[model samples]
Target chain A: MSILKKLPSKARLEQVKKLSSEIFGSTWNPNNIRNGSKILRAPLKGPELVNYYGVNDSMPTFQDFKKWFPELKLVDPREAYRVKMVEDRKKRNKGAPKKKKE
Target chain B: MPFRFPVKFDIPKHAYVNARVLRDQFKRIQYADNEVTRNALRYLARNTELPAKVRLEAQLQLTSMPKYTSYSQIKNRCVATGHARSVISDFKLNRTAFRERARAGLIPGVTKASW
Candidate 1:
């Protein structure tokens, strides 16, 4: 889209939360999404003691979910990351002491 | 999307349908321009007896079309969020949205890696 957001915002978050609920509502509980992973033990007397599973369940990384929000106007991370890196480098070097001459 | 000038239409990306329409329209323009250019060149190539004046005129006509009609000028944006950059044409989503939706199981079979 023409208008691209460089950073995440509350509006984007709210939008995706609504979407996650809409898409996953039939299958998952919203409360369980952000609860992180859990271990489920095999039923009855099965030899499989425990099955380690569920990383954020159906929920993706907080920032990663913004991709699905049609109105957020997100930009490519490649360009955003590059711009961030350059800005960071400039900031990091701004206060450095001058090198001594030989 | 932006206004695709010389085509007398705006690329309306505020909404998904409009964006899609714009992209499709530009693609059609691109194809038509290419066909026109190709046919003109073919006529020039096959007509050895054609006068130099007509041949030069055909070449000029081919170059006269706006570059905006070319497909390369068009970019795919995520239909959901209207996000730019790294839009996967197959998925019609930006990288972030694709990963999220795929993880959410909106897209079949593909899942996100937790590690």
Candidate 2:
């Protein structure tokens, strides 16, 4: 007979496994079933993926400048021309209908 | 131009917009918005320890979400021209645009190879 004692019982092995798993902060999955932990382990790609389009850094138009700094009293020449054309059209009675005063 | 509706910031006038680009933008937005919930449900559905009914319910919910919410649907498109094919992700420009810009000295550090 060997000097060493017999192998530990199945229940005792199970207890040891459970305790070790608990101590090590690991999942006690003796059945080796699917836990879907892989999915959680993968980093979330949402924030980076959404920002892939990048920020809009287009040159600010005159209208935008006015919106940002109203005190500057900036006037866009194109807008002035458009308003003048609209006035001309209104004088000729070709403008859009006025909204009803409720 | 990729967005049909107004966003927080103004979209540049030169940004190309088309039906495909519009759809891709929608998918990207949806994916970003629902990614967390989708992953959670996926985890639940795949977990064998969970009750069968709960797992089934999670799967059903996952299926009910829009197909656009999936990341695989997003296709990289040219930011300048909205072309779907041969897009170089580094500059987000298609081959033609990339070649034109590179030759015009628009893209930095890219010179014509004529040795």
Candidate 3:
């Protein structure tokens, strides 16, 4: 074997690289710099994250039900309790002070 | 259900919602809503050939978006009771809820382990 084996020329090497990339259908990035293509190729996590909690039944609350059927005159237990407490407090003269008419 | 968040997000809410659970729900919605735009901005910010001024602008815009829009802000909490610790992701329940449901045979294929 020869002491100094001749290496391929720079132009020949470049040609070979271009041909290989073309054959393999790969990007010909000569400078080998960041292109950020990976970001575009990445799968979106939004749909999966949004669906993590499953479907919302969208159950209507007491207020919503009452709004939909105003004629029903639904009495919420908590509201009733609050009204009773306020009434008892007023009877004992411990209720909120009346707003003075300006 | 209580309309707790500052802006009402159209997302599912559990019956036992509290401040923490509401925060998580907010993060989830923010992330899902901005994911595509965020990705596009990230690509623009990272592309080396892009003008430095444009890249910096993209970076600034990305940072200006709410921190809640990042996936890292999301945390998995117990869906049943809003418990933070020892949650089983598959069931979305904390250990306490998981044990109770398992014992009650409410969870399919879950049985008491006996040696």
Candidate 4:
């Protein structure tokens, strides 16, 4: 019945992942890896989970990490680079929003 | 050196309600119901305000009480009430992601280059 219950899990996860990536600066990785996947998955635990939960001193176990992010995959650095480049290119083409002259 | 006596302090019931009650309640409901409730509880439990309120209540209770409770005591109650268990299944379900992120540098303080 609480407001928190209404948020979509997938959307919430995405938001958390974005925040986690920002705070951890890409240091978050699940413990699984596949040779061809575009994403890197790491078990969420210890400091990472604590950070994600927004708790100052709580430690999250591997099991805790798994519960929150289910779509995690091993992100190859090369693949990540490729993805980043593509995204950057798209952003550049879109260009910054035009500033209004005062 | 003189022998020092250990001073014990207790946390209040309001603190328990604010810091721990909602979570414990949600977990209880989540476990007692089916998948839908479980999923709903997971989302509901994420509310930042709820936990803060609980904590505030606990603080108030602690300030007003005669007999004080320890932090561990509060934690044990939460665990005993099954608040901590709801997420364990979710954690197990998401283990793959955790592993993947670990392999990558997505986790803070973990280097990506090392296998």
RMSD of each: 29.2, 7.5, 6.9, 29.2
Q: Per-prediction DockQ scores?
A: 0.01, 0.37, 0.41, 0.01
The best candidate by DockQ is: 3
lDDT values of the candidates?
0.54, 0.82, 0.85, 0.40
Task: Write model 3 residue lDDT over B1-115, tens digit each, in one string.
Answer: 3676666775564345767877887888889889999999999999998999999999999999889899899888888888889999989899999999999999999999899
lDDT of 1 by residue, A1-102 (tens): 557656669878767877886887532444454211121111221111111011223455434646667588767787799888877877889544667888
Residue A91 lDDT (model 2) = 98
TM-score of each: 0.35, 0.62, 0.63, 0.16
Off by over 4 Å in 3: A1-33, A58-102, B1-6, B11-15
Q: Report iRMS values in order.
A: 30.0, 2.7, 2.5, 15.1
Off by over 4 Å in 1: A1-102, B1-55
Task: State the lDDT of candidate 2 residue by residue for B1-115, as single tens digits.
Answer: 2546433333334457776766777677778888989999999999988999999999999999878789889999998888989999989999999999999999999999998
| DockQ score for model 1 | 0.01
lDDT by residue for model 1 over B1-115, one digit each (tens)?
4555445532332334454545554554454446545454536634445777876776676567565544355555666666668888777788998888987899986876678
Clashing pairs in 2: none
